[model samples]
Target: MPVLPQVLALLFVVTWGVGAALLTSVSQLSPSGYDFIIIGGGTAGSVLANRLSENPQTKVLVIEAGIRLVSHLKSIPVPDMTCNSSEDIQDVKIPFLATSLPSTSVDWNFTTTDQTGLNNRSIKLARGFVLGGSSSINFMTWNRCSNDYWDSLATASNDSIWTWPAVEYYYLRTSTLVPPSDGHNTTGQIIPEVHGQDGPVQVSLPGHATELDQRVVDSAFILGGRFTYNEDFNAGKSIGLGYVQNAIGNGTRSSAATGYLLPIVDRCNVDVIISTRVTKISGSLSASEIDTVEIAQSANGTPTKIKAKKEVLLSAGVMGTPQLLSLSGIGPKGVLSDLGIDVIVDAPAVGANLVDHPLVANYFTVNSNNTWDPILRNSTLFADVLEDWEIKRQGLFVDTPGNTQGYFKLPTYPGGVDPSTGPLSANTEVIFANGFAPFGPMSFPDSGSYMSVLAAVVSPTSRGTVIINSTDPFAAPVIDLGILSTEFDIVAMIQVIKDIQTIVATSPWEGYVTGIYGDLANATTDDELTEFIRNNAVTVNHAVGTAKIGEVVDSHLNVIGVSGLRVIDASILHTIPECHPQAIVYTVAERMAALIKHQYGI
Candidate 1:
């Protein structure tokens, strides 16, 4: 009925009423033209928007498929300033509480194709569809990949830039390291030299870790006696028992949208259009460059074409990038033909090489009163916990829930041979959460409090694909998350479970543990464990390698057959890292920004 354009601090906000129709006119464009048109204003895209738009003359526009949640650094939602109710927006700012939020709003909620390895069961693939992307919804752990993982990428693409020495610079550039509160270096857990002081994103430890955390770390040392105590994994190596760092600051989630985009929203050259999905790139099939992008605010709304003068950067993440490329006819010939779409690049590797860590959750009941479940289970204590966080930015709410994490190599079994490759570089990641079923709603049994330890296979050999299911641009992609598909991976998982059981059964941990649950609880032998694994396998939610470097794109992240079009997100990773992929994604985006700046001499 009316058009309202409210411009404040260079931000142009456009609001629409319920059931508003798309403008009949063509999509509007700036006269000077944007130097970069970034799709999906998520983690990487948000960083690009901030870095590329630093020069006032350089114009950048970010088209996001989800809502814009941050406007200013102060306005960004924090755990303490947010809500006590899980139904409220503040729930997202709380690290552990975020996982319990419904997927209807911010998550794409895509499921995998029936995983043949796991008894033909389709697993839920919860990808963030909101601004800041998965960083906004993921567990706040900020562990980086192992040096070997980077070396593997360098070898895969035949590029030395992917090596640790080169890539670590980008990691430093993306983060503003927060040292452990107590100033001393060796005495405290965190290492200061490994961190950068001046950067955009903030990296900090949990505000309030529980006593159970220390016990877990001590237990891990007892279980894996061979590995050294690595206080900081982000420094380079990730093979030891230590406190897992998180993307948090002052008891709040420091998401990409909050850290990178919000503080610089006042830049005159940067434009962010949220709640808009880019359907396809309307460019020549034979041509090497992009012409324009087709996008719609609503699913059924009319698609509008907007020109991209310089380049179109696809930072839409692992799932979105591959799906968008295929929708634009830049994928396998057979897949394009099946969907009746014109073949643009015939890049068979576009959606192939999909890899993700397979996780098996282990639950334990605590014999002591040290568990966090009782406080969470009691209404009055829980209310006090919420109030303490909201008022003082302290208490259990400030923690990431999982206080201690251990990364270790699988021990060589007695009378058993190891993989031909020899000792692996940290294959298993064990996270010890304080309370029972922290992955789900804060629930507990009437009998006793519980703790959860998730043993996840970090370096999986199984590969799968993310292919288009239909010609409809908005349709969900078919994701075959081939987790634990190989016998090698299954064997590794079995060993990791055995290690967890051993750790739980040891001195301090053994004294605290009263019972066990899930796959291992009922199983005694390896045969029973294998069946339990097949039945309980789940993703760690670290999906990558769909459109990888050297295959779908070059070493520099340029799409193989297209110019003025680049894929610079998790999709460009040669393989899923042995740790969380968020830090790697941030580093990639930082490097991409530097490369683009150098290319344009900006």
Candidate 2:
């Protein structure tokens, strides 16, 4: 045989071998059905699906509103490309789209009635509509709420099972911690023994850290406080200053759907339906039990009925979960009656107890000497960042600009146990992002506030409610955040503003920091700073407690007045966590799934 022909034959054989392996892995996934149907393949839904399907005998169906689309960008750990591109931001903005609804596709696109605390201005609320739920589109910063917040739930609900120690086990079960590597932080350190090393979801420090992150750490300590490096904030103690660990793994985004759902797609007992929007849940409501569920499909715009052999789980998140309950006639009696929805359960607490982390960004323009300045203003440089993300999966993109985070107990009432003694009545969550903008520095000025520090009031006393506007399931619900409506909430926010201003003023970067408002460069009064914050603050979109657990659902997350139907998402959080709600959602979903499996013996 000729040498050229022999070489070509060898090349063909190698290509064929690679192709065969790919086909074999892809073919392992087969369509299947389940006895229990879980709606929304998001944070909780994915965990529910994974845990429920563990039993070979039990069939599980996860109905996701969006498809499972994976790409290099989705998996990378870099932050440069994470929020820079339009596609990345759009995906992060709304992971799922409602095909049936025009203009508003994947995103619920919710808005709160004017927040009186925030200068009486309305803010946009974006919730995920995709398989992984909001876990796919969220900021990805992982921080479990403080012990006090979790302990309070136990006290309020009078359930020992809701205690911090009980929930801490689940947090450990679902997390995989990535310790800080050398040269990443000069002073910061993460304790690996306290964090989980071998878990499905990836939690690691960003590969790259800008100089600004170090300055923030030094500034936080300069503010005259103990700043300890936190390796695993998920351990349930989210205090002190440390590098923000995120849900990204191996330089790629590792959402719940990716970590939990994709790995089990081949299971014969689990069925995942994409592009399915569940409009209304119809069930037989006799006294306190629900026996059936009729879900509407967005693809064909029709409804299908399915009988629940055990229970129907609602992992539809804060927005969808409440909306589903209201549509099924399980909310306030008068509200449902007005909407012409037959009152099945008449649970008054269905859409009450709404809570969210309101964010206020304090911006400062750094000297051109700042590392991010060149890339922040140049599109070509931005393109290079994306290419680096695509090829090496290493660069600035993996770093979530807010590299360092801290939780502080702020003094609220005069002589309020002197925060030095114990946990204060209110705590402020400070997140420092390295980039100059909110979404992206170059995208839109109104969008990005330069060198932003998002200070959220972790434990606000204010509560709000969500109500249906009309009988139409597609109609957007009316949301009243009632933010800062309570005196305590206002006081907490004011303290946060003061804390942030003090950090910026006394920090090592005082010379490097220039106020967002050019004229207020020398402003020092607390009132002036508070006014600036009120005008600039926005919601972090970590909304929860709408269909609060315990109040609306039992310990197992089942609606109090309805059996077979349960809410296993952020909506069921008894109260907002002191940290981001994503990590809590993952833990709750995992625990909920175990509860369901044990209940059904499947």
Candidate 3:
């Protein structure tokens, strides 16, 4: 069982007097309308607020459901383990803190319906309820999709603006690249022309990567057949091994709230309110536009109506955005009717086309001294490392653990690895981390160390749904990821597992691992490997496509059949990108800002 904390102590843990003071209280807010009322002050919402509020003439009001807390710099732990407590503040300025578990107080903690594809097991889906959203809680790997994917997005929506050549500018404009540590990448890993230097978000390599990370990269080279080192994965083609670029700088997490909003909190035109959930969107059906957003708490305990003059932008993320739409009578008519809610728009695609990356891994026993598991197991070592992290932000504490990542395609496999629906993007990703398996229980040898090579199926043919459980706006939605719900995806996962085994058996990477887990290392056939995957498959937490473009929204991200509304978050992604969606989401928000500015002539 989990322990509870003192409520009073939590509420006052840190004073956000700097930025939180500028926020409006429910009672303090006047009934005055703003030019834009953005719901969910999350990853993309923070960006939207910063860019949209740049117009001195426009007033932007952002309502976030989570409260603010001062962050403490903490050391990184083994992957998938919870490190930060409710009292622990999340630093918006820190980028390496992505692997921390979903903070209970701030995380929506949604779970999927029993997956028929995966033995009827439900998976936990974590979404940040805080001001910065999942960007505040996600691993900050700075990677983008292949140009081909973005080009297809343009074609899908019948809009040239979504093309790679046009949208690529926003990708550059959103991030300021910081080169890796001088000592580690002396051979030059980053390509200068590919990144921007004056953007809001900060992107850089880990301060120092482990020897194991380098060995894994070297092993890719040892494979010698289309397995060469990629100097930079962000150059539109990421299909090889390399050091991962992160969103960390100055030894802290640089979330959208810190990068975009923290710097300009004094702007009088922008008003932010925390711990206030938007329950429903109310407007006249005849106008085909939104007029006001109803909040959980009114000034006098009744529902409060915050009006939007220009538009109501929904940056509420993949799950929350669609739930709010359904609640506000903007989703499928059948779903709304079942919940006893009148349908504003009978859009069937509103909660459909869910996508996510499903992952499974093989564990290996290594030298105790080579891996960092010992540090986490010993209290004294953990304390020392945590102290070092709090003070200097160096050593094992600063490592993003999985700072080394590899991407490859499995084209020719036993049961067909090609995506049944989408383009031929790389179907597999191997993340070499400095710990044991990212998920599941481990049976460690008495003294030997352990590390994990997580292989995730990035290009999955499986589609899921994010439907509202009931009309209750506060209830969690029914998220059915339907992972491995397709035959191609299943075969692809099995093939990737075999490929990882082959890679680890090579020179440099093989030298580190003393032994491998029996189920994979001993299995001789693909069917055995497939069965292991069926039992151990887990999500990489890369959920997207629930409310995607070309289906729910058009090129501009405006919810189809509606006016004065737009979705500017991961939910709008046509498909989950080949890489992490943080950087891509930033690009999407940037492009949306430009589009909104041009459309309304702001």
Find the candidate with the highest TM-score and give its number.
3
What TM-score does candidate 2 get on C-alpha atoms? 0.84
Once superposed on the true structure, which residue ranges of model 3 sit more than 4 Å away at CA? Answer: 1-15, 18-24, 73-97, 181-183, 284-287, 297-301, 413-417, 420-424, 441-447, 518-522
lDDT of 2 by residue, 1-602 (tens): 00111000000110111121111221232334247878788888889888888887887767776644432223322233312222232233111111111112335567778878778877777776666777776667776666776677677567777677887777778878754332254333565665666667887776766766677667656654534445446555666666777777655566787778777777767767666667777665563566555555443556666656677788877877788888888899989988788888788888888888776655566553544545545555655765665466567666556677877776445335332112622366887766444421123342222576667877766788888878666667889888766655556676776677677776577666666533234445756756655566667778988777667888777788766788888887777777777877887777677767777777
lDDT of each: 0.74, 0.64, 0.74
lDDT of 1: 0.74
Residue lDDT tens for model 3, 1-602 = 01221111111122345543346477656456689888988888988999998887878888887765345433422222433334334443334345454645557777788887777777677778676787777777888777877877787788999888998889888888765533355355678688888999888877766767668677777875545688888887877788788887656666787788776678878888888888988775553577778897432446777778889999888898889989988888998998898887888888788899888867887765857666645656655655566667666656566778877777575454455223435678888877663453234333447778888888888999989868777777888888888877887788788777787778776557788864667666877777777777777778888777888888888888878888888888777788888888888888998888888788
The true-structure Cα RMSD of candidate 1 reads 6.8
The residue-by-residue lDDT of candidate 1 on 1-602, one tens digit each, is 00111212122222222221212223544556578889988889989988998888888888888765632212212222111122233255655565543354567778888887788877777677767888887887887677777778788889898887888888888887774322224335677678767888788876675767677667656655644566788767788878878888767777888788777667778777777888998564445578678888777989877777678899988888989999898999998999898887899998898999888877887766766666654555555665676567677767677877877776664336432222435778888877665332122455566788888888778899998888777788888887778877888788888877777776867567788854467887888888888877788789999888998889888888888899989988877788888988988899889999999887
List the RMSD of every prediction in angstroms: 6.8, 8.1, 3.8
Higher-ranked by lDDT: 1 or 2: 1
What is candidate 2's CA lDDT for residue 230? Answer: 51
Model 2 segments more than 4 A misplaced: 1-33, 70-106, 179-188, 226-232, 284-288, 414-426, 439-450, 514-530
Q: Report the CA-based lDDT of candidate 2 relative to the real structure.
A: 0.64
Worst 10-residue lDDT window for candidate 3 reads 1-10
Residue 454 error, candidate 1, Å: 0.7
